[model samples]
Target: MISFSPTEEQQMIVSMAKQFASGEMRKIYRQCDENGAIPEGVIDTAWKMGLTSSSIPEEYGGPGGEHSAITGSLIAEELAWGDLSMAMHILCPALFAYPILEMGTESQRKKYLPLFSDEKYKAATSGLIEPRFGFDPYSLSTTARLDGNEYVLNGEKCYVPLAAEADLLLVYAAEDGTSHAFIVERDTKGLEIGEREKNMGIRALTTYELSLKNCHVPKENLLGDPRGYDFNRIMNCSRVALSAMAVGVAKAAMEYSRDYAKERVAFGEPIGSRQTVAFMLAEMAIEIDATRLMTWEAAWKLDRKEEATKEASLVKTYADDMVLMVTDRGVQILGGHGYVREHPVELWLRNGRGFATFDGMAIV
Candidate 1:
């Protein structure tokens, strides 16, 4: 018995998110992309929406509410619909806070959770993707070795969002052939912050390369209990979130192209009336719907505390293909206009290309 409808509360959040996306994010996305930075005002405005605060318990100095992956997925889709890079920037804190809330020790939660729940938006991020070809999360190039009561970390992490000003970083590495997340403070010795990466897409989001040279942290910094937290679960949440983002980006491209095709006339006929254009739009719509359903299903399973490894992987793989296909079709439909910088279809296509490596950019 599976229900695909959103709850009342979920609907409300989705509506609010959609408004924010359409009004604020869409208005400034291009400028930010060209500038290679999201304005602080834009981020602060989203923060006031209580995206992070509402999830924390009242006991932890937040407006009490449950953290639902389905709701998060809904919200994420709308936000990314406005702009992918800004959406990632707005949600970066979750990359650090959600993992702690999900599997951190009681003390860890008490220490770190409140930071996110505070009145102002806090900069916190995660480091997972390493600088190497054929990177795998399960088989990390980064290594963590226990020495006495502390763990020593040795690795280079790339594409870490908000790394320049992030107060806290949840660095993932392999220890005894198992993935583990370590909470490292920004000022920790031997942890060097590299220059901001000039990425192919999502350029508005500030990402950096990091060099960890014999960095050490107390055993308490390890997330979860002695048995260790479920790394797979975290990865699943990340996949679902990324899948939702792909849906948003694809949806935006589809709608824009659809509208363009209807209005643009060639030889006194709307291009959309032609069979080839109509069929391509139809296929794009079908692919987007299929991918959205898969993403929502994975998010639903995650909210119920069920294993969603397969579903998450399925949606991620499907979305990886769907977004590229849809955006490419959008560019094709728009002809010369799509290739120009004034139009967003090319930008969407560029952002959509990074779906293959979007592992730790988001979490739910």
Candidate 2:
């Protein structure tokens, strides 16, 4: 019996996340987008919510809460509804923590999991997306070879969130044709953090390009050493997280356009009363709900510790199209007003366009 209904605790988490999104993130998303920087205070406020640290066990200096993909999806959608950039930025630490928590060795967990429990926001992130055409996660261009006691990494990575400030980075590379994650510490030799990337969307969340020229990390840094971790499962989790976020973005666009249609009158009648406008709005609502359910189903599969590659991939593909359609419809409904910065529909459209490229940038 699959239930889309969230548990009471999940509902509580969603409500809290919605408040943060509406109360905090919504207040400054436009300015953050325009300035290409989110205020530190806002980031600090989100950090206090324990969004990333609550799932770790008490032995790791954390709050000892269960980690659930479904709960993470619910929280992710609400936070993304507030703003994608801030939402991604706030959750970036999880990009590093969750994998280690789930798949790392005991020594790895003892060393790294405690870092996330700190009072301040820890700068940690992952590197997976490369800068190239026809990028595929399975066949990574980055290569790693075991040399002596260290793994020599060689490749370039782009769109790495908070790379400049991060003290730790979980860099994914192809080792003997199998993709694997290596824990690379900041200041490691041959690991060059390049200039911050200028992206078309999610502009406020600073990302960077990286050059790893024979970068050497201890063999012990290999995630799930002695036995490799499941790269497919990680990718599935990432897909579900991003898909939920797409639903959130689309939902935001739909509700805003729907409200605008009801209020923005033309020829003494609300545009929402018109047949074409009503149909478009109806379709947007339908697609957004459909995508949300798809996201939840994938997330539910993940929580069951089942293989969710097919479901995750399907939802991700659908979400990529769904968000673009809904946001474009939002712009269409608003006419000229949607093209301008005065309204957030244009911003949502811009942010919505980047979902297809946002793999490994988020996770649950």
Candidate 3:
């Protein structure tokens, strides 16, 4: 029989992460959102927790902990519950490090993994989403052509987290009609980092658009080098991560609304005592739990090295809708209060709406 219960170690890690989320992320989320920036001290605190570097091997100057997708999903949900923007920003380096750790050549790991093990937060990110009407990760518009010792890259990417500060970027592009990732240094010629983007949600997390015109990277910079990495598997991992985050965001909204309904009286009775409000809360709880379970299943498949494209895709789609529904209900429950910036429900609603377009913005 299969079990979804986390291991003892996993539980301990989750508990630690939960404390950090509630104690640190929650305290300043609104301020960060308003300012459109997360405090450097907060990011450094999270980095000190070794959230992103713990999985690297001892030889690479890390704790050599097992890297499990389920554990990643659990941590992701809790962090996102505290605040989506801070959660994404805290985990941004993982977007670059994890991929390389899992798929990069031995030399690549030796060269890059150590950078993440530093005491300070290292800025590294990925570029996958293109700024187009119908963007598809598998069928990217960015193109890379191998020429002698270098690969010439030409394309535009948007919604790249920390693009302005990232010292390294894993840029995905189509190579001979196949999607592949190329490691480009920050100062690479023809790689123009655009101004920060203003989005509807996750406002605290800085993102940028990039223009690559004949950008050249050493041929060896291709991830996994001689044998290319599995692009599909990478996408699946990202889907699972995003799905878990959706569960977190939805759960936060549900709990907040449920508490409010208990205290806010209408007709001389608490709003939660009413059937309509109670039923919405019940539905929100059920759907959030369902999505979390689905996300866990996908993460489990990834840990087992099983093909999880269909499962990941299904959970991602369901979570995208579920988060929007739950967060909107959160605002609806608060009536006029939800529309105001003072409450977090409106912020969550905005963040929830962007999940559909958040491909590769997160990863497990």
Candidate 4:
């Protein structure tokens, strides 16, 4: 039986996240988005919440609280409700730590997992989403060829979040017709990072393009050892996280438009009282709720160690469309004000447009 109810701990986590989002993140999100930079203090406060460390095993220098995918989805929605770019910046470490915890060898876990537990925010990111048209994660353009004790990587990757500041990167590539991830240190030779990308949305979160020209790493850096790892599962987790973020952005647009419609006068009455405006708001709410439920179901399956590839894809596709529609409608409902900078609906709509291509920008 599926239960939608949050446990006591999950409720507490949600409350805490909500408080932070409403009080801190929401206040500064606009400024950060405009400046194209997130404040270090924001990242520090979020890091102190232990969103990443609590999941690591105590033996591996963590809080021993264990990972909960469903709880994580809830928290992600709340944080993203505050701000998308800041949420990604704050949780960027998970893009590195979770994969290691899930698929790394015992030695690899011992060597790298402890780095995420420090008191300050440490950027550890994942390298996926290459720079090319018609990209597929399963058949990465980045190739890792074995040369005795080291694997030589050759390809270019783009949209890597926090690349400039990350202490380490988990770069995914194709090896012998199979997908695998390698742990690459920040200072690897022959790895040239491009200038920060100026994108249409999520601008506050810095992304970079990387050229790995014969960048060699030790054979031991291959995640999950000789048997390889479950790349699909990791992809599924990413899909769930992205879907949750879509829900957050959509919910924000819907609520803001709804409130504006209620207050703004039209023909000597509130616009929300009209049939067209009321119906649009209702549809937006329905879609947001539906998308969130799909995300929760996918997360729940992941928590149970069940395969959620199809479900994840389902939610991601639905959310990608749903967010675009909801945000566009939000702009439409607001008429002229929606397109203006003073309101955030236009910003939300711009950000929503990129959801179709936002792979590896975040993880759960």
lDDT of each: 0.91, 0.93, 0.94, 0.90
* Model 2 per-residue lDDT tens digits across residues 155-247: 999999999989999999999888999999999999999999898889999999999999999999999864648889899999999999999
Candidate 2 structure lDDT: 0.93
What shift in Å separates residue 302 of candidate 2 from its native position after superposition? 0.7
User: 328, model 3: CA deviation in Å?
Assistant: 0.3
Deviation of model 1 at 159, angstroms: 0.7
TM-score of each: 0.98, 0.99, 0.99, 0.98
Candidate 4, residue 128: CA error in Å? 0.7
- As a TM-score, model 4 comes out at 0.98
Candidate 3 yields a Cα-based lDDT of 0.94
Report lDDT (Cα) of residue 217, candidate 4. 94
Q: Relative to the unseen true structure, what is the Cα RMSD of model 4?
A: 1.0
| lDDT digits (tens) for residues 1-364 of candidate 1 | 7687898998899999999999999999999989998889989999999986788877767787889888888988999999999888889999999988888999998999888887688999999999999999999989999999999999999999999889999999999988999999999898999999998899898999999999989989998995548899999999999999999999999999999999999989999999999999999999999999999999889999999999999999999999999999899999999999899999999999999887975468
